[model samples]
Target: MPNLDDKNAIAFEFARICSLAAVKIMEIYKTDFESRGKDDKSPVTDADELAEEIILAELEKCLPGVPVLAEESFAAGFRPKTDGAFILVDPVDGTKEFINKNGEFTVNIALIENREPTAGCVFAPARERIFVGGDDAWAGTLKAGETVSPDALDPITTRARPSGGMTAVMSRSHADEKTLAFADAQGVVEKVSAGSSLKFCLVAEGSADVYPRFGPTKEWDTGAGHAVLNAAGGCVRMPDGAPFLYAKEEVEYLNGGFVAWGRID
Candidate 1:
C-alpha cells in the first residue's frame, strides 16, 4: 500500500502538471488557435497538443518509467501491463468550451494505483482554479497566488436526498436519450447543462445534485473529477450505484455509464 506521504506527493505533482498545462492552454486560448474534429467528432485544438506535450514531459521527469495513458498519446499504443501503476491525463477536458471561448475547459490528471485512482487534479485556468484529491482530503478553486489550501475534510456524500426536487446536470455536447431517461427516472425538478468535467465539479460543489452520463467517455475524462467528488463529500457511481474505477483493460480506456451525485447513499 502507498503511504499517505506518497499519496500526497502524487496529488501535488499532478496539480503542478495541471497548473503548467493551464498556462500553456491559456496562451493558445488568447490567440487564434486552429481547431479540428476527431473521428469521434469531438473538437481538438493546438492547446490540447501543447498542454499534453508539456504534461507528458513533466510527468516523465517527475515519475520516471511510470506508464501514462493520455488522450493525446492514446494512439501511441502504450498499455498498462497490470501489476503496478499508471497516470491518466486529459489535458483539456472541455475542448469545445475552450474552442468556443467559454472557458469551461480544464486540465485533468490522475494517478491510478492498482487500477484505482489514488490521486487526481483538475485545473481551470480561465477561472484560475484548481482541485486536487487524495487520501488526506482535497482542495478546490485556489486563486492565482494562493497555494495548497485544503478542501473541507468532511464525510463524503453518498446520494442525493430529495429536497422538494433534485437537480440534474447533463453534458452540453453529448446529452443523449439514455442520460435523459436516467434523470427522468430520478424525477428531477430541474436540469442544467455544462461541458466537460465541469459537470462533475458542479455536482461536487452542490450547485447541482446529480450528473448522469450515458454517452461514451474515456477514463481520463472523469478520473480527476471523480477523485474531487470523492474528496468533496460526494461520489461518482455507475448506473447500478457502484463506484467508478479506472485503467481497466476490458474497455479500451472507455468508461461505462455512471452517475455523479452530490451525495451518494
Candidate 2:
C-alpha cells in the first residue's frame, strides 16, 4: 500500500492524476462546449465536471475514504464528511480563461491537513506545464494526454527579494481595490498579470516576487498553488504577517485576503 503520510508520494500521485484529468479537459476544450453559471454565478463547463469526476475516481483508488471538497462536487451539493484532514480540488481554476481559450486555466488538487496544504499539484493543460509540491517543489512539461514522470521535472525554488522593488503579479480578472493598494504600498516596480493559480507557480519558480489578493476566494482555489509556493521556499500569509489557515467551515471554505511572497525575508 502507498504511504498516505509520505508527502513526496502524495504529490507525485496527485500530479499524475491531474495530468490525466487535463487530457480530458483539453479534449473538451477543443470542442464547442458551452459554459453555464452555477448558483454562485461562477462559470463551469463540461471540462470542469468531467475533470473533477476523473480526479475523484482516482482519489478513491489512491486514498480511499478521504473526504474531498472538490469544487464541482460541492457546487452540486455533495458535501462529504470533512471533520479532519481532507483534500481540496479545483478541477478548473480559471474558467474565464478556459472560456476565452487563453491557455491560463489549470487543474488543481491539494492535500489539506491541520489547516495547511501538505502536498499538491497544478497542471495547465493548454500550456503543457505542471507544478507539484511534496517534500519539495518541481516544475515540468507534460503534454496533454501524456504520461507523467517526475524524473524529468526540475526542482523549483523562489528567489530572494530583489534589492530594488518587487515584481507583483495580480489576477488577470479578479482585481480589487485592496489588491491594487497593497501593490502600490509595497512600492512594486513591475507588475505582471496572470489568471488562476498560475500566479503562485510564477512566484514558486522565481519568475515573480509576490502575488497579492484581498478579494473573495475559496479554499479549493488556492490550496494547490499555496502548497507549491510553500515548498518552493515561498509562503502565503495574511497581510498582517499571520499564517494563512484553511478549513473555515463557518464561511463555507471561503478564504480571506492573503498575499503570496517568493520569500518573506
Candidate 3:
C-alpha cells in the first residue's frame, strides 16, 4: 500500500482515478443507455459498473492490498474486511439524476482513517467540475477526456453564513418531508435543489450554508463529500450534534440523519 501518512499523495491519486472514471462516464452519458434496478430498487447503469471497474483496477495498482468498500462491489456481495483505514467509493452517485440527463451525478472516492474521512474527491463530469479535499481543499475545471494536475487546482473555502440569512442546498432526488422541514427550520433565505454529493460541494465552496439530509444514505455516498466539507472548514454532524462516523458494522454501512454545515456556529 502507498504511504498512508502521505495524505497529499493519496488525495492526488484519488483525484486522478476519479477523473479517469469521469471520462468514461461522460461517454456513457452521451449514449442512449437504460438503467436497471438493484435489489434495493435503486437504479444502476453501465456507467456505474464500468467506472467502478476502472477505479478498482487503478486502486489495485496504486494501493495494492488496501481494502475498499465500493457501492457496486457491495451490491455484488463482495465485502472486504476493514480496520483502521480503508477506502469508500461510490462510482456513480445520483444515478437518478444521470438517467434524467440533468448533469448532477458525480463520481466519488474517499479515504477513511479510524472511521473518519481523511481525503476524498468528487467529480461532476457533466458539470466539468472536480472538487478534492484532504490536507487542502480545491475545486477546478476538468475537460472531458483530459488529465489535470493537482497544482492546477484552485483552492476553495467555505464562507461564513450570510448575515442576511443562510442558503440551503437540498437533495433533488431524495428530499423528503423531514429534510424540507429541517431546511425550513434553518430559516434559510433561499433553497437550492441539487443532486448527488454536489450538495456537500455546494456548501464546501460557500455556495450554500447547510445541507441537512434526513433520509436514508450510505457511508459511501457521504464519505467523500464529508472529507471535502471538512477540508473546506465545514463539518457533518448528526442531528443530535455528534460527529458522523463511518464503517458502522452493525448498521451495514447505512448512515442516519445528519446535517452538513458550512459554518458551524
Candidate 4:
C-alpha cells in the first residue's frame, strides 16, 4: 500500500476519481431523470448514487483497507467502522441546484487522518472547474472526458483578508438570519450567494474571505472542501474558535455550525 500519510498523492488520486465520476454525472445531467427524498427529505438522484459508486470503488483501490464514510451509503444504512482514518465523500453536493439545472453541484472526496481532513478533491463538473489540495493546493479548469493533469493546474492560496470590508459567501438555499447577522457583525461589505461546497472553494482560492454555515451538515459535506481550504492556508473552525474536527459517529457525523476563513491578516 502507498504511504497513507502522503497526502498529495492521495489528493491526486481523488482528483482522478472525481474526473472519471464526473463523466457519469454529466451523462445523467443531460437527461430527464427522477429525484426523490431520502429519510431526511433531502434530494437524491441517479447522479448521486452512480457517482458515489464510482468514487467508492476508486477509493477502495487507492486507500486499500481504510474505511469510508460516504453520504449516500450512510443514508442507506451502510455504516463502516473507522478508527480516525477514513475517506469522506459527497457525490452530488448541490442536488437542488442540479435538479434546477443551475450547474452548481459538485463531486467531493477527502482523506481524513486523526479526525482532520488532510487531503481532498472537489470537482464542479458542470462548471468545468476542479480543485484539489493536500500539503499544497491547486485549481484548474477541466472539460468533459478530461482527467486531471498537474501541469494543467495552478497553485492557489487564500489572500490576506481584504483591508476593506470583507466579502462573505453564504449558502444560497440555507441562508438564514444567523448567517446574515454573522456577516453583518463581521463588517462584510458584500456577499456572494453560492451553492454546494463551492462556497468553501471560494475561500480557498482567495475569491472570498469567509464562509459561515449555521445549519447542520454531515462530515462528508464539508470534509473535502475543508481539506482544500486548509491546504490553501485557510481553516475551518467552530463558532467558538475551536478546531473543527471530523469522524463524529456518535452524532452520525453531523457537523455543528462553523466558519471557514482565509487569512485573517
lDDT of all predictions: 0.77, 0.92, 0.91, 0.91
Error of model 4, residue 134, in angstroms:
0.5
Tens digits of lDDT, candidate 1, 1-265:
2333477667777887787777778888899989998766777888898889999999888888888888877744656553478788999998889888887788898877766777788778887667777764444555332444444223233345677878998999889988888888898889999877878877766678899998788998988887777767777778887867776778788898899888756
Off by over 4 Å in 2: none
Residue 261 accuracy (lDDT) in model 4: 94
For model 1 the local lDDT of residue 86 reads 79
User: What is the Cα-based TM-score of model 1?
Assistant: 0.87
Q: Residues 1-265, candidate 2: write the lDDT tens digits.
A: 3576889789988888998898899999999999999999999999999999999999999899899999998988887766688999999999999999999999999999989998999999999999999889999999866777678899999999999999999999988888888999999999999999999999999999999999889999999999999989999998899999988888899998999999987
lDDT of 3 at 89: 95
lDDT of 4 by residue, 1-265 (tens): 4577788888988999999998999999999999999999999999999999988898788778889889999999999886768999999998999999899999999998889999999999999999999999999999756878678999999988787988999998899999999999999999999999999999999999999999988999899999999999999999999999998889999999999999755
TM-score of every prediction relative to native: 0.87, 0.98, 0.97, 0.98
Tell me the lDDT of candidate 1.
Answer: 0.77
Whichever of 1 and 2 has more TM-score, that candidate is 2
Residues 1-265 of candidate 3: C-alpha lDDT, one tens digit per residue: 4587877678778988998888889889999999999999999999999999999999999988889999999999998887768999999999999999999999999999989999999999999998999888999998755676778889999998888999999999888898888887878889999999999999999999999998999999999999999999999999999989998978789999999999887
